[model samples]
Target: MARTTGSHSDITGPRVRAAALSLFAQHGFAAVSMRQIAREVGVQAGALYNYTPDKQSLLFDLMQTHMSDLLSSRDKLPETASPLEALETFTRFHIRFHSERPEEVFIAYMELRNLEPENFEAIEKLRRTYEDQLENILRAGVSEGVFKVADPKLATMAVIAMLTGVNTWFREGGRLSLEEVEQIYWDMVRKSVGA
Candidate 1:
């Protein structure tokens, strides 16, 4: 396809992804059509092909982008920091990050079964990388005798599940602020690990 000077992929690409993310979050991956996504982007359906080849590719891209952003934005816990400090950082960061992108987070979990095998593998790999960050923190904390976790791997899964569960029920003005929620989760995470 010939490139048009005004129809830039840089601008349209993200819009396409965002539209797809919202649609897939609102309707299951099986239910959302490329034309609906194109409408959401205010472009013709054919224009969507300029950004993604097909719906499967678009879903994979959304998931890949979500996981990539997750890995990139994760806190870089310093070696000098204590296990408790590292854990608190991870806990708070996890809650806040997931909360900020409820749609992406929702699709990330809800649409996993929709991914092709290769795409599923790629997303799972990125998920493991994110999980490993906390696992290492837990291991370090245990080694330092600051945490009494029975299994770092299991604890990593538990902490992530507990933190992510917040997005399902949390609202900005209903009861507590996100900061307050983070504090409460931090306390629970700390005690769960016996910090």
Candidate 2:
């Protein structure tokens, strides 16, 4: 099908993806219909096909976009000197990045089961790339005797889980500010690796 004309064309694609992301985050992928997404986007059910081939494609696109953004943003941070500095940077960055994107983070983790095998593989590849960033830091720390991580791979997984878990309970106006939370978590991560 030909694309929609005029300014509407530019915005419709993003709008559709945003609507689908919100819906899929609230209701599982299996539970949300294309029509529901179209309704949310203020477009006809058939019109969604102009932007996405089908629901599965839309789901894959959302996940792919989220992971891509995560990688791109991470790559832009300034390089740190020591492995300890890099690990602290990674810890603070993960908490801040994942916290701001609660919805995307939720769908990224919860909706993985809904992706087809190939799509799942692709998303997992991107995820591993992100994880490897931290794992490498741990390995360097261990090599330099700055950290005592027996298995960098296992330490990577644990640190990521601990940082990501902040999203589940953190709020803007609660007891601690996000900066404070970042510091507290960084301290815990530092201790965990024996840095």
lDDT of 2 by residue, 1-195 (tens): 565575666889899999999999998899999999999999899998888899999999999999999998873445547888888888888999999999999999999998999999999999999999999989988989999988999999999999999999999999999999999999999999998
Instruction: Assess candidate 1 and give its TM-score to the true structure.
Output: 0.94
Taking every candidate in turn, the Cα RMSD to the unseen true structure, in Å, is 2.2, 2.4
Cα lDDT tens digits, model 1, 74-179, are 7876668887888898899899899999999989999899999999999999999999989998998899899999999999999999999999899999789999
TM-scores, all candidates, are 0.94, 0.95
Clash statistics: count for each candidate: 0, 0
Candidate 1 off by > 4 Å = 1-7
Query: Which parts of model 2 have CA positions greater than 4 angstroms off?
Result: 1-6, 75-80
- Backbone clash total for model 1 is 0
Which of the numbered candidates is closest to the native, going by highest lDDT? Answer: 2
